[model samples]
Each structure stands twice: as C-alpha cells, then as structure tokens.
Target: MNPKNWQLSFFRREQRSLFGEILDWMLTPLLLLWPVSLALTWLVAQGLANKPFDRALIYNAQALAQLVKLSPDQQRVQFNLPQPASELLRADDADLVYYQVIGPKGEILGGDRDLPQPQEDEKLGSYEVKIRDDEMRSLEVRVAYTWVQLASDKSPVGMGPVLVQVAETREKRSVLATEIIKGVMLPQFAILPLAVLLVWLALVRGIKPLSELEERIRARKSDDLSPLDEKAVPLEVAPLVSSVNDLLGRLKDSIATQKRFLADAAHQLKTPLAGLRMQADLAQRKDASEEELKHSLKQIGRASVQATHTVNQLLSLARAEGGGAIDLQSCDMEALVSEVLHDSLPRAMDKGLDLGYDGVDTDSKRRFLKVQGNPTLLKEMIRNLVDNAIHYTPSTEERIGVITVRLLVDPYSQALAVQVEDNGPGIAAAERERIFEPFYRALGSNVDGSGLGLPIVREIAQRHGATVSVDVAHPGQTPPGACFTIRFARASNKFKTNMASGSADL
Candidate 1:
C-alpha cells in the first residue's frame, strides 16, 4: 500500500478506545502495587517473628545460669536445675529444647551432651539459627548464651567463667508467626479488591455528566441551532460547550439572513409579475380601440421583458450564492468575452451601437487568458457587465456609443483581468458603490434594469477569488463611460484547460 494508506491502517490498529484506556490506567498501578504490598508484609512478619522467639531463649538461659554453682575443689561447676524448670526446658511432643552449661575453658557442664556450643565470639545476646534434631527434622531455633563469674579465693571458689546456653525448635514460633501474617494479610486482600471496585465505580460516576450531555445533544432536532445551557455543566466541559454554542449562534445568524433574502426576492418578483399578467389580459380584450390595444400590448411587452430580466438576475444571484456546489473549470477569458460580445451583437445592432471584442488574439498561446472558475457563472458575470454597459450607453446617429470587451493576462501575478468599457454617461463616485446592490438603480438613468445584474456579477467574481470594481474607461476625457474590471487571482494549468473548454460554448 501507499504511505498514506499504510499510516491510516497503522493508526486504526493502534487506536486505544476510551473505555479501554481508562481501565488500563486505573488497573495497572493497582496491579503493580499488589506485589509491593506483599513484599512489605513479608518483611514485617519476619521482623516480628524474631522478637518473641528471642525473648523465650533469653528467659531460659537466665534461669539455667542461676542454677549453676561451684564445687569445693573449685575445679568443677555444678547445675542444680529445678524439676519444674527442667520440665519447662524439655521438648513437648516432637518440638525440641536444648540447654547447656560450660566452664570458662569451654567444657560442657549440663543438659544434652550433643547440644551445639554457641560460637566463642558470639555476644551475650539472643539470636535465631537453624539446626537439625535427633530425628533429623530441620528446625528454625533461637539461642541465648551468657557467661557468669564464679566466687573464688586462692585459685578462686567461683571466679572462673561459666557459660549458660539455651535453645528451642521454632515450630511453635513458625505457627504463631504464620497466624499473625494471616490475620494481617487476609483483610488486606479483601479490602484491595473492594478498593479497586470502588475506584472503578467512582470513575463511572465522574463521567456521568459527559454521557448526559451526549444524550441531550442526540435528542435535539437537526435544525435546532440554539445555545445550550451552561450553568449546570461541569467546569471541565463548560469551555467546549460554550464554543459549540458560539458556533450555533453564527449558524443561526446565517440561516436567518438567507431566510430574509428569500422573502425580499419573492416580494420584488411578485409586484411586476402581477402587472405583466394584468396588462396581457387588457391587451387581449376584443372591444378595445386600436390605440388602447396598442398601448396595452406595449405595456404588456415591457412588463414581460422586465420580469424576464428580474428572473434571470435572480437565477444568476442564486447560482453564485450556491457556494461550492458549482464546479470550477479552466476558461479562456478572451474567448469567453468574444462569445458574450457575439451574443450581444443583435442587441447592439438594434440600437445602432458600436459593439466589438477588443484585444482578442487569434494565436492560442496569447489568446488563452485562462482562469479557474465556474464557466456558467463567469459568462453570466460578463453578460451582466456588457448588458449593463449596452443598456446605459446612448444610441445616436451622430456618435454611436461604443462597448468594448477586453481580456488581459499577467503571468507574473498569475492573474486574469476582464474589462468591459462603454462610452456613456458615467456614474458618480458615490453612486458607483450603491449600483451593485439589488434593485438600486441610479436616479438619472432612463434604461430599464433589475439592478441585480451588477450584484450578481460581484458575487460571481468573489466566488472565484476575483475582485470586481468600476472605474473610468477614459479618464479626463469628455463622454467617458463606466469600465467594469474583474481580476481573477491564481490561475493554474489545470484550471486553464477546464475553463477554456467550458467557456468555448459561452
């Protein structure tokens, strides 16, 4: 596939939907936190397990040290351990306890002969160790060892050192610690899921306003362009909603303007149309005198022509206002002007006016003043300008009015300009601006016109990225008439061909 298609496909595949994205964001951290919580709980349990076990061994060792006594010879040490204390030190069931007493020289004094000695450098403090029993069962055990000074004289009665060591298997401690961890971790496990569930619920609740807004919009009619209520909207959504309302306000204004224009156009058309019908009926009356009949017929013909002109102008304006629905094609301005002038030939001849297509080149290269625009609208614009020129120019045997249509192409500016000049009474500077408005005819002009022609031309020119303006055809000269110039910007090769071919018919 091409790069654009490939990129679109990749984007589609990588698109993470809204709900999925939210769920991933909400759940991933919680999942990662679960392992961290477990590790922390294990560390705490291990730390706590050592405390009680160390205390038990310390108590045993201290009791056993008290039972130690020196013999008279002072060379031997004796242990007078009590039966209750001995029983307390004995292993219950399969659990094992070991105790030992040693001389300063590291000789074993009491308890099991097989019991291991504490390391010589081992501090007089409690610690935990793992060891094997007579049954070969591995056990985690705690040991406490301490040295005592014996009372002695003349080689000392009990001055030499004696060590007391006590140890017990950790099966009971293991069970107790396991129970403690279960008590602590089980509730947390339950609460973890509950916490996740609560978080998901809260996210859904927080997003409820957006869903309500969607529903409200979906329920609205297509034509409804009214602003939405913003008072109760969430702060995060208010800005977007306000922008939408602003867009709706603009659209409402556009729709209202179009409706008013349509109403005005109807009103303008109805009045003349009614008069034309009435005049036609009067002309058809059988009993009318010849003079009366002739006058009625002339009035009917004038009204009919006026109505036709008005209708044509209205159609041109409508076409220009239809926006981008019209296709823009390449056209030759010179050829288009020639065709328009040819079409106006009979009208000019009837008035004995001098009509001509000036500056038209026969060579295709020089003749092709190409432009990109809707050809039909382009022709209508030219026809209107030329027609307006023809209607305003005076016709007399002494000096005939001349209407010239010219096309000029400027390659450096990429522009095509069409000019229609007439030798007639020119409009005043102030009236020139108002002449392009619909139904706005100049005060002294005797020519019949709908006044929509110039406006339609202006609209068509604008739609094609062109500018239309009126100026003097012959400045500082007597009998100077109005010159209408349309300058189209940005002519391209493709546009040239389309417009040229389309305007061939015009």
Candidate 2:
C-alpha cells in the first residue's frame, strides 16, 4: 500500500482501418508491376512480328539478283523482267513493295529508279542477301540488298559491281504486333480487378474473429469482470488478451479491498459514536446531581476523544492504501526512531510505562544508520510502531511496563533494523501475522485502540521494501512481551569500524 496518487492519462489517437492497411500492403506491388509487364510484352511481340516478314524481304532480293545476266551485245549488265513478274512483285493490299538494281557502271539496270540506295560504307556480297531498315517516301520500311557479279570469269573493263535492293512498307508487321499484344494483355486487364476483389475478401475473413471479440466484450455487463479466454484469440493477439486479463484481476482485488476497508471503518467507529451520544444524553438529564453531571461530562469527553482518534486512524490507513511516485533518499533511520520515541514519551509517562531509546550513536555512525526510503513515510512507520508499543503494554506503579525503541546495524552488510520491544502481554504465534490486518485487535487486550497502528507500520514498511516481523521480547518470562522489527535493505556506503552505541531512559 503506497501513499500517493496512481492515476494514468491516455492520449487519444487518430483511428485507422486495419483492413484497408493490410489490403494496401498486399496489392500495391502487384498494381505497380502491371504497367511494367505490359511494356515488356509489347517489345517481345514486335520482335516476333518482324522475323518472318524480314525473311520474305531477303527472298525477294535474291530473286531480283538472279535476273541479272549479260546483255545480248554482252557489253554491260542488263535487266529483263516479264510484265507478269513485275506486276506480281508490286501486287499487295496492305503494303507496297519496291526493288532496284544499279549496273556496274552506276546505270539503272531494272526495276523502280526511286528506291533508296544502301549507305556507301555498306559491305557488298555477290548474290548474298543482307537486310536493313531505311525510309522511302517518308514512310518506314524494311530493305534487303545485295551486290551481283555479272560474270564470274570477268566483267567489262570499266565495270565494277551491281547492287540489288528490295524494301516493303511496315503496315503488315504492325498489324501482327497489335494482334499479339491483345492476345497477351487483354486477359491481364480482366484478372487485375478479380485479384483485388479476392484480396478484399481474404482481409475481411482474416479479421472477422477480432470483430467478434469486440462484440463479445461490448455485450458484457459493467459488473462482469471475468477474464477473456486467451486460447480463443489468434496466437499473435494472445499476449494482448492476457495483459487485459491481468489488469482485470488487479482491479477486482482493489475493489474488494476498498469494500472491506469501508465496512471495517464503519463497524469500528459505531461504538464510540454511540457512547458519545449516551454520555451527552446523561449530562442533560433533568434530575442529575452535580457529581453525576461531572461524571457524565467526563465520560462524554472520553468518548469524543476516542471518536476523534478513530477518525484520524481511519484517515491514516486510507492514505496508506493509495499510491504514487515516491522521492527516495538515504534517510537517518535511527534519528526517525529517536524522534518517535521522544514524541511518545508523554503518552508512556501518562500510562506509567518506561519508554527509552537505545542505539548506535548518530554522530559516530550516521552513514551506517541510513536507510533508503521516503522520509515522510519512514517517519510515519516509526511513529506507528512506537504508538503501538505504548498503547498495548500494560503499566502500573508497582511494576512499570518497559517499552524500548532500538536501532540495530548489521556490521557486515551495513543494513539497518528498527525494533520496538515491549515487556507486556505478548502476541500469540498463530495471530502474529493476523494482527497486521486493519481493525484486528488482540483477543484479551481490553484496550481502547484503533488497531490501525501495526497495519500502518506494515504498509509503510512494505512501501520502503522493508520486512516487518514479530517475536517474543524475552523468552520464558511471565510476561513474554512482543518485539516488532523492521529490516530495511542496506543503502549505505563503506562503514566505519568501532561504532559507538548510546541509550537513554525516559
């Protein structure tokens, strides 16, 4: 039970769609690659369309080369083709075909004269066909050309070589490439949308369980704090569900503690309030004597004082039950103990009990006496232990009850322990732990105490990471008495040897 605020604040965040995010991740790469696939397919189709058409242009050029032979005079190369053959060459619906042959002396031998010539740097072969892409009439065309030797034996003295060339328009090749593109790309256009639809359906199916879980949680009643079944959720989400279950368990325990505290406080306060009311009524009686009136007033004062003490104790316990961040320091544990003993001296004297302080000297071993904890809480814890000792120990003039607060230091570990020991009716072994529970008093103490002192001590000790334990102060004695020791974790540095000890009786 820590004693400060423990509230948490959560910032509101912008909401997002999980389904939309997942779908985008799955389909973005596919959509991005579609256009790239289309471009590559178009390039491949163009290559396929040109292969057979290019071969046909080479064949036409070879046929034209065969037509070259010696003229009748045998003076120079001549071209002679039948009208049917020439008409057959030009006959085409989609594309126009053209051919040209230049004699060895740069004379036009046969065929169309308007055809474009190959570049001068082009290699020449005798009846060997070659192909190139060139332009005629501002339109793109494929050209096949060759150089022809009129006679293998010899040519005319001034003659060198002859050139034969053939070209055709690109319309037919374009049409075939267009057809191939449609064959491959049309199906892809249709399937892209289908793929997107399937992705949407798959995402919807994947998160369906989460939606159902949300609905189940929403339908639960406010008081129904039962844990969610971790096994029912997906493996990835199980950790989240488990965390929520743990939080619910803690909340349930907190609610139960608050309820029990309220009930105990009410039960403990009712008796003193009733007594105060009775005493007040008696003091106002119509036929009361002076001595009776004085006695009633005294009783009223005692009851009122008891009521006030109960309220303060209730508030102290409530404060201990809350929690928040604590500022820790290496505090002088022995100093706090001495201060508490000094404060409780009057009460001990009033009850005729011997109150004293015994410990290592603060001036000599101040560093070794330090404990790491919140100073305020540490003081409160020591105050509660001393108050408990003063309240429970029986005192009388003949045999004075002795209550001592001792500060112990572990010479080897440097840890410190604060102990409150009383020579009075001791606590039974079975009820020792139970006595730390709020409002639980000893069975036959016959004391008018809040019973919150030991509980407060335990609470504060726990907050400081200290342990509290009770045992017999003096074994085998008629009144064995009780000793409460709080052992704190060592928080000091190197210790000094030969520590001085001190004690004072009050």
Candidate 3:
C-alpha cells in the first residue's frame, strides 16, 4: 500500500474513535431538560392567573345572598336588588356576568336562572371554578354559593335555606392566564436557542485543540518520529499525547537498530566475497601447477563455507529480533546438550581436544533437569557455544586442549544453567561484553571462522529469557581458560511429571 493508505489503515486499527462519544455526552442532558422546564413553567402560570379573580367572584355572591327574604306567609322567597347593586355584576368589559337565586323548592327566582347546578354533595358557602355548558352557551366561570335564612326565623326555618350563586364568563380569566404563560415562556423561547447555540460553540471550541494537534501531526515528515509536546494539549488529553510520544520514541529506536544491522551485515559479507573472487582468478592462470590450482580451489571452498555460516547467523539474529509470541515447550537440556556435543565431536577430534559432558547423571535428578524454550533455537544456542569452544581452544604440537559441556541446575536458585568451558587462551575481562556484539572478535585471536557464533549464542539465550556471561575457568593459572555460561529464568513443569514416570518405570 501507499504511505497515505497505510497510515490510514494503521490509525483505524490502533486509535479509538473519540468524536461521537464526546458529542453524545455534551448534548443528551440539554435535550432531556428542555421539556421538563416547559412543563414546570406552565404549572406556575395556571396558579398565578387564578388568585385575584377567585376572591372577586366570592365577594359578589356574598352580597347577592344578603338581598334574600321570606314572604309573610313564609311559604315563598323574594329577592329585591336595587339598580346600582345589579349593575356592578356586569362591570367587567371583556366577560359577561351571571348569577342565580333559588327558593327552598329548587325554583329559579332571579338572574340567569339557567346556570349549571353544582353536584348534590357540594359543600355550602364554598367558591369553585369549572368549565361547563349553560342554556345560553358554553363558557368557563368561577362559582360561589351560600345559604341564607329569612328575617322571621320560626316559619322560614321550616321553609328551608335560600340559595344564591354568582358566575361569570371566563374571557377575563383566560386572557390573564394566557398573558402569564406568554410572559414566562416567551423569554425562554428566545433564550433557549441562544443557550443551545452558545453550548454548540463551546463544544466546538473545546475540540479545537484536537484539530490543532492533528494538523501538527499531519505537517510532519514521514521519517520524523519526534515526540509530541504534551504541554500544548489540554490536561484531560495530556495522557493520550504522552502515550503517542512514547510510541514514536520506540519506533525511532527500532528504525535506528534496523539501519545499523543492515550496515553491519554488508560489511561482514564483503571479505569472504573478495577472497572467493581472488582465489578463482588464481585457479584460472595458465602458469599455475596442478597442486597450486587444487590449493586455490580449497581456499575458495573454505571462503564459501565461512560466507554461508555468516548468512545463517544473520538469519538467526533477525528471527530473535522480530518480536512475537514464541512457544516455550519443555526442553531436555541434557538431551539438547548431547545432540550439540555429538555434532561438534568431529571438530573436537580434528583439533585433538578432549570433549565431554559434566553434571547430574542419576536418572531421577537428570529427568527433572529441563528448561523452557523453542527446541530449535535452544539447540542452535548450544551448538554455537560448543562450536566456539572447539574452534578457539588451541591444540599445538606441545599440548592437547580440552573443552567440557555441562548441564547443571543451581541448588539454591533453582535456575537451569548450560556451561561451555575451554582450557585455551581465555578472553580478557575488558572484551567480555563486546564479544557478544555482532561480528566482533576478540583481539589477537586468529581463529579461522566468522565472528557470529558467540553473538548468536548470546542472542538466542536472551530470547529464551536467559543470561549469557564469560568467566575464567582456571583463575591465576597460566593461560587461564574461558567459561561461557547461560542461566535460564525458570524450569519446566513437565520435567517433574517425566521424572515421576521414569521412577515408576524403573
């Protein structure tokens, strides 16, 4: 894929989508609270419009009740009202007024007798408002009713209580209620949108810093892996910026490591290739004897072998560097060491060196001696250590050399260790660490091999969560020999099961 497409895919896979989540949190509360506020405002408006008009309707009914009287025979009722007293009832210009008076027999006696009756259980001398239809038309009105007795108490008491009710068409009350509702809600209608708009603008401003950060990232060159400035971001976003900066720093180090590896690989490959070319040229010369040509061919073969070894080591190092999950199966250190020793026996015999194994040989303890690692890489690591010992230990005409391979577990630490020791010229303390670096050989050593073996040993040991170090085999002796040791982190559980089975079989 192209760079742009690759970057897009990378971010899609790696980064969380943040915009929709932020917007949902900001706007959900505003939408829910808007309708709640409108309902509360409507309730308050209804109460405000009803207070004064209810009292006015009650006062008029009390006055009309005072005009009632009983006849001389006390069998009938009469209500006498002067003109001015009656005119006060229709005083409101916007609404028609209504009133009713009833005798003891439930007969309508005065003023808009068609008024709707109250329920039979309605309490006397109480004021209420209702919306109802009358003989004239349907209207909303306030209602008040009261009981009155005549002046002659004895016969009129038997005649029963007089009834007076006052009512009005509801244009005035409705107008007042509507006015109150508008007063409360109109300002909110204007302010609510303004508030929403202000909130929208605030959200936009809040996210502006993210846009700036994106633009800064987009402006950088493809190869630029510098850290982002965390202080430039909001405090809430600083953690995200810090994480991104850490990733960039690691990526930079990885790229630098790859570049160095490539450079070192090229430099190591050059010498063997030049020797092959020069040897081939010598074999083609007309003046060369048969023996000379044979020697030239032999030299070319040796150079080819060295080049192939270097290439194999490079591939092994690359596999170790590639970070991924590796299956760490239970490994038989003794068996693994034995296989490597068998492979290196021929080389040791050619050098006339004594090569042997050391450590626990009992069946029970031996079966328990296991490590966790990739079997192939573990074997490769053992092979490199044994091969290095065989190659470096000197076998001169005066004295024979010796190399020992040991597989032992530390009693106290419970750590499994693989050790390869040689009684040849040991490495100096100053160069011990450097010897593990790729293509770096110890000074004054003229061994005819690629310098990749020890480095490969160290890299593979590290991949298996093991540590590799060198120490003198015989301290304070002449030509103190070298011992390369690899100590693993933990033991394999399968080892115990295998040991138990072995014990039972025996």
Candidate 4:
C-alpha cells in the first residue's frame, strides 16, 4: 500500500467509547469545581474563626479604658486594674496576651511597655474599641485599642486622652480556623469520591441500552434484514433506527427485483433454446426428406435469431439499469429519429408499413432543438419505440400500416418531445405503467417480443432525465393507435411550467 493510504487506514482504526465520552463530560466540571469549592470554604472558615476572638479583645480594651480615672482634684489621668483582671490576660495556655496604657503626655501608666500605640490613621472611637492586626514581641497578634478623654483640665497635670490597648497572639485563632476547616472540608473529601462513583454508575446505566442493541443486532442471522425495534430504543435513537429500517426496506425491494428478473429471464429463454434443440434433432433423423431437412434448418435459423434478439434485449436493459458509462453528448432529436427510421426501414417495408419521420428540417439544426444525452442510448431508445410501432401495427388489403416518428419542440417553451405513433392495437391506460417492467407484455397481445424494449427505452430516458408515456394515438377508432412519447424537460425551465399549465399539445 502507498504510505498516504497506509497512514490514513492506521489513523482511522483509533476508536473512542460513547460511555467514556459521556463520563468525561459529566465528571470534568465536577472535578474542576472541587478545588474552587475548597478555597472558598477555607476563606469562609478563617473569617468565622476571627469573630469571637476579636469581640473578646474589644471587651478587654474597653475594660482597661474604664480604669483611666481622673484624680480627686481633676489634675491627672490614672490607669488601674484589679489583680483578678490581670490573670485573665494569661487565661488561655495556647496563646499569650498583652495590654498597654499610655497617658496623653506619652507617659507609661500600666501594663507592658513594649505594646505599640495605634497607628495615626487608626480611627479610634472615644471609649469605643477599634481593632487591627500587628506584630508584637516577634509574634503575629490581633490588637484592639481605644482612646479615653480625660475629664480634668484645670490642674497642671491635665491629660487630653488616654490609650488603652490589648494584644493577643494568633495561636488560638489558628486552632479555631483549623477546626472550622476540618468540619466543613472533611465531609466533602469523602463525598467527592462517592460523587465520582455515582457518576460512573449513571453513565454505565445510561449507555446500557446501546450495548443491548448491539447484542440484539449481533444475535440475528446474517440474512435477517428485519428492522430494529424503534419503540424499544430511546426517543433520541428512534430516528436513527427509523433510517436503518428505511434502508433495509429499500434493500429488500432491490433483492426482490433481482430475483424476479432472474426468474423471468430463465422463463423467456427456455422456448427458443428448446426449439433449437428440437430442430437439430429433427434434421439429424435418418428418414428426414430433403424438404423436411430444409424446413428444419430454417426453423433452426429462426430460433437462433429469436434467442439472440432476446439475449441482446435483456443485456441492453441490464446495461441501462446498471448505469454503465453514460457519457452525455449532444444530439438532435430529429436526426436521431431519422437514423432509427432508416435502420428499421426493412422491417417496416416487410410489413407494408408507412414508417416515416414527421419533424423539423434537418438543414435547420436549431441549437435549442438539440438535446444533451448519451448518443448511443438515445438512438437505442428511439429504435425501441420505432420497432414496437412497426411490430404491433399490421397492414391489410383495406388499409396500409402507418407508423410515424414525430419530433416536436414547443415554440414558446422550447421543450422537446419525440413520439412514435402507430395504427395498432393500442395499450389501455391501466396496463401502460405495467408494460414498463422487464418481461411484462401487454395483456391479450400475440406478438413475439422479448418484452424488454419499452422497459429499456424508459430506463435510458430516465438516465437522461426524461419521462416516457404511452397513450392511444387515435382514440375511438377501429383500432386505437398507440403513441409513446419521450419528453426531455431540460430544453428550458419554462417547459416544465408550460407542461404543468397544459399549454403544450404534447
């Protein structure tokens, strides 16, 4: 194999499962959103962990603010805390706490001297606690601070405001946050795997029907062309199954056509083959007279001719049906009819028939009058129509057989039509369509024919996008003549509209 084809074949062999595709679509979003959910939960836990601790820090700062009292003479601000209140600072073993107080004149009053003052940008409310985060003693801590207004200004040591601040390390907040994270995230860790498992199981259940359908198709015998059960499948799959059923129905029709063609072919060939065998045996008889021998030879020749004609007709119909190499070339309808008439002259004359052409002048050769089609098939189609007319039309002492091959083009629409008319036993309207089937002869007709001529004509006409119709040529006469018309619609678009409007006589 060539490298390009080999590469293509190799690439096409790669397969993907529908179940796997569905699972990936379902679970990919879930898996991707899981980490997002975790980050949001952790952030929420941290905010929640800080709430109670911050409130406690605010209360301690307020308590220390109350302790800054005015002296008896309203001369100074002082800070004091009960000894029992001091132990509350170190109550929690996991975290260290610190507090500080500063006089307005920058004097250290009470508590740890290392506790930093609030930043200048801090909006400290009067005796209302405000909190911030800071580093104190080389450890991260939460701090709450408030400013107190001293009530004394008359004395020399008058103070403007006192600062009361409380600071605590973040060890307790970290533990609390860890606990919150555990409470919220632990369940999800377990649920995530279960969610994936449930998703996997759901996909398996969802696609189980396809698997069952495959098994049903596989279990059937090779020749079984029965349709899949559309009702049993899902609504989404019913349309696909319906399409498959339609294909199967067409296949069945095609197979039946082939079988019928074979049976009819065998039946049609049997008579001439048997005639040839009998004629040969008779000619070989030892007591056969000279006249008898001559007649046998004649019979043998007639049988062989009949056999050859039947086989050729059958092959022609088969080739037309098979659509073999129909390369289209433009040909004049009038010229083609003239050619078929010339070829069928001998046969028509033998029957004393007036086989003639009624069409446009050959010298004119108008461009619009010409048609596009396979020339060989077009001639074959015309020949069949002309032959049928000559074969069916009979001449007698009273009247001569008149067979006319007429070519017509609509003057306004330019649509082309070819008609073969004969004063023969015309076909009834009911049997006209049936006669187009292979080996289907008209009812009550004694003519010896392969019954494939009209069928071949119809097939070839169809290949060129034309329609064939058979109707009585002369109605209400002694023998209503048959007229076969082939209409080529591509002469112009207006032709279709004209034909529909019944404006064209053809």
RMSD in Å for model 3: 6.7
> Candidate 2, after superposition: displacement of residue 392 in Å?
1.6
- Provide the lDDT at 250 for model 3: 75
RMSD of candidates 1 onward, in order? 9.8, 7.2, 6.7, 5.3
Candidate 1 lDDT: 0.75
Candidate 2 backbone collisions, by pair: 2-322, 4-323
lDDT of 3 by residue, 1-506 (tens): 79999888877865554665666676688778878877886777666766687678777888887788777665578888788888878777987888888877888879876787766665353223333333335666666667665546565345666778887776776788889878888898898788877877887898899999999999999999989999999999999999999889878866876786687679878999999999999999999999999999999999999889888877777666645557889988888888888888988998899998886756645755787789988898889888888888988778779898876653434656677888899999899999988778899998877678887887788778888878888778778889887768553444322221221111
* Residue lDDT tens for model 2, 23-63: 88899999989989999999999999999999988888898
Best-performing candidate as measured by lDDT: 4
In model 1, the Cα lDDT at residue 31 comes to 88
Global Cα lDDT for candidate 2 = 0.81
lDDT of 4 by residue, 73-133 (tens): 7766767788888997768888889999988898998988988787777745579788789
lDDT (Cα atoms) of all candidates against the true structure: 0.75, 0.81, 0.77, 0.82
Off by over 4 Å in 1: 1-239, 246-250, 283-286, 289-302, 323-339, 358-372, 409-412, 489-506
The C-alpha local distance difference test score for the whole of candidate 4 amounts to 0.82
Q: What is the clash count for each candidate, in the order shown? A: 15, 2, 0, 0
The true-versus-predicted C-alpha distance at residue 205 of model 1, in Å, is 6.9
Using TM-score as the yardstick, the better of models 1 and 3 is 3
